[model samples]
Structures are given as C-alpha cells and as structure tokens.
Target: MDVRELRNCFGRFATGVTVVTWKTDDHEYNGITVNSFTSVSLDPALVLVSIDKKAKACQALENRPFVVNILASNQEPIAWQFAGRPQEKLTLEWEETEVGPKIAGAIATIECIPWNAYEGGDHILFVGEIKAFSYNDKDALMFFKGKFINN
Candidate 1:
C-alpha cells in the first residue's frame, strides 16, 4: 500500500482549515495550520485537533491550552504563514484569549483547555475542553484534494 496514495485518499474529504495556536511560557505565540480539527462531544463541550509528531506544535501544546482559529475565506495568507511558507511581510491582528492568541478576523475561535491525548500513527490526537467560543458571519476556508477553497 502506498502511503502517499492513502494520504491523497484521505484528502478527498473536504475539511475546514484552522490555525491551532498556543502561547509559550516565554510569551511567544505559535501556530500551525491544520485541517484535522473536529467536534468530539457536546455535554463536555469537547473538540480535538491532530498534530504531526514531528511538528513543533506537537510539543508546544502538551498539557497547555490552545485556540482553534477557524479560518475565513479571505485568510489564505495567514494559513500559508502558519503552514510553513511564511510571507516576508505578514501582518496579523491578534485577539488575546485566556488560552492563547487567535487571528482577530477568523470565522470562529474556540478556546480550549487541554483534556486528553492519544497516539495515532504519526499524529497525536489532542482533545480540549471548550472553555470559550466566538464566531462571525463569514465564509469559511476549506481544504479539499490538497487545495484551498472558499466555502
């Protein structure tokens, strides 16, 4: 079985793009673009995001609070920045939350406190208890077949 082919098959499912953000102890803000976020439960208000084992955020988010910034359609630049192709002159307006910082213009922001973790192949599934959430009326940024689309 080809792993690349498996990845491509998985990519066929459309998902909303998100920037999983957390602040370091030294006050530095960090983020990574992810499309593997999902709602887990309602009674406990749970959510989850998967981070690759080798990704820096996998370490940064350990036992720490984080914010899920659901990208808006026009926020492709921000997504590219966190996805590793950072722009030379990227300017972002940040909204500081108890958990971390989020892009001010995100379609929605979910503030969460670390709840649970589990290993899944090359990724670690991090679950969070929703502490707070906010949203705006706007189109979402979506990922499908390895491309970004506005929806």
Candidate 2:
C-alpha cells in the first residue's frame, strides 16, 4: 500500500494528543504534536511513544529522558504551538520532575526515563520506565483525521 493509504488506515483509530518533551544537555526541546503514545505495561508502569526517525524531537530523545504531557481539551492552542504553527507566541509554565519536565495545564503528566528503543518503519518506538505521574479529572485532548476534537 502507498503511504497516504497507510496514513488513512492508521487515522481510523482515534487517539489523544500529547506533547512529548525532553532535555538535551541544558536545552529543553519538545515535539509540538503527537498521537503516538500508549500505556505499555501496568505491572512495571511503562509507556511508549513513537516519533518519526528524522524528526528533530526524536533525535533529541535518543538516549535521553523525557516527559509526556497529556493535554486537556482546552489545550488545542498548545498543541498547535508544538505542531510548527506560526502564531502568537506562547509561554507554558512547567514543573520539573526527577525524570523530566511537565506542562502545568496538562490533564496528565508522566515523567520517564528511556528504557529501550526499536526501529519501526520511518519511526522509532521508545519505551520508557515511568518515574513519576500526575493526573487531573479533566477532559482529554483528542485527535481525529488530523485535527484536535473536543469530546
């Protein structure tokens, strides 16, 4: 199948939007938009995120610790900011955890250390060992057919 067809097939599965952030040296970097996140194992409290192998964010995450910010429904603007949109500048407040950084307004935040990575198509699947986590009883930011939708 062609790439577009593959993308369409994958888009059939709805997903939540998240901004995965990480630090490189002293500089902080983040992926503005991602739908490739999932809980891996509850026994060990592991999570996984997939990023394009060629993306700068993925490159930055290599061998580095990171955090996943599960956005709230109202965080569409933040999602856009991370998705390379040229718009009014936004400054997000965040807190540091033992493993990584987390956005303050996120519905949930998980800090994790890099556990392992595997090559998959044009992307890399990163498994993380959860170090810290937080959650709020708020609606989640969702993605469908390339757009964020409130549910």
Candidate 3:
C-alpha cells in the first residue's frame, strides 16, 4: 500500500491529543503535538510517544525529562500551536514542573524521565518512565480520520 493508504488506515483509530514538552541542552523550551502516546508498562509506569524524525523536538528529547500534556477538549488551539501553526496574539500558559513545562489547562499531565529510545522507521519511539501524573474530569481532545472530534 501507498503512504496515503497507510496513513488513512492508521487514522481510523481514535487517539487522544498530547503535547510533549522538553527542554534542550541550552535550556530552550520545545514542544510538539503528538497523537502517538501510549502506556507501555504498568509495573514500571512507563509511557511511549512516537516523534517524527524531522520534528525539532525529536533531537531535544535525547536524554531529557519531559511532560506529556493530554489536551482537553477546549485546547485545540494549543494543539495546533505546538503542531507548528502559530496563532497571532496567542499567549501560552505554562506550568513549570520538576520534569518539564506542561500546558496549564491540560486534562491530564504525565511527567517522565527518559528510559529508552528505539528506531521506528520514519519516527523515533521514546519510552519514558513516569515519575508523576495527574488528571482532571474534563473530556479529552481526540483525533480520528485526520480531524479533531469530541466524543
């Protein structure tokens, strides 16, 4: 199958939107919108996020602690912001944590340390060991079939 076909097949599965935030070696903040976040192991409290090899945040993730901000239904603009679409007059609300900076209004936040990274074709699969986590009762922002939707 072609790339478009594979992408369409993958898009059939609904996924929660997340913004993975990390600081570079120079203390520069970096964040990228990701939908490929998943829980890896329970005993070790591990999570995984796939980052495109070409993403700016991909290089910054090496050996860095990061926070995964699970976007709430009302945070679509925030998602788009980190996804490389800058909005005019947008002011971001950042909550500094021991692991990294997290979006202030996220429904859930997971703070993690770098555990391992593996080659995944065009993407890098980063496994993180969860150090802390919190969640609220808000609905999550979801993506399916190339569009955001409320469930």
Please tell me which predicted candidate would have the highest TM-score against the true structure: 1
Report each candidate's C-alpha RMSD, comma-separated, in the order given.
0.9, 1.4, 1.1
**Against the hidden true structure, what lDDT does model 1 obtain?**
0.94
Q: How close is candidate 2 to the true structure, as a TM-score?
A: 0.92
Measured against the true structure, the TM-scores of the candidates, in listed sequence, are 0.97, 0.92, 0.96
User: Positional deviation of 57 in candidate 3, in angstroms?
Assistant: 1.2
| Order of the predicted models by lDDT, top scorer first | 1, 3, 2
lDDT of each: 0.94, 0.85, 0.92
Better of 2 and 3 by TM-score: 3
Candidate 3: regions farther than 4 A off: none
How many steric clashes between backbone atoms does each model show? 0, 1, 0
Q: List the candidates ranked by TM-score, beginning with the highest.
A: 1, 3, 2
Instruction: Give the clashing residue pairs of candidate 1, or none.
Output: none
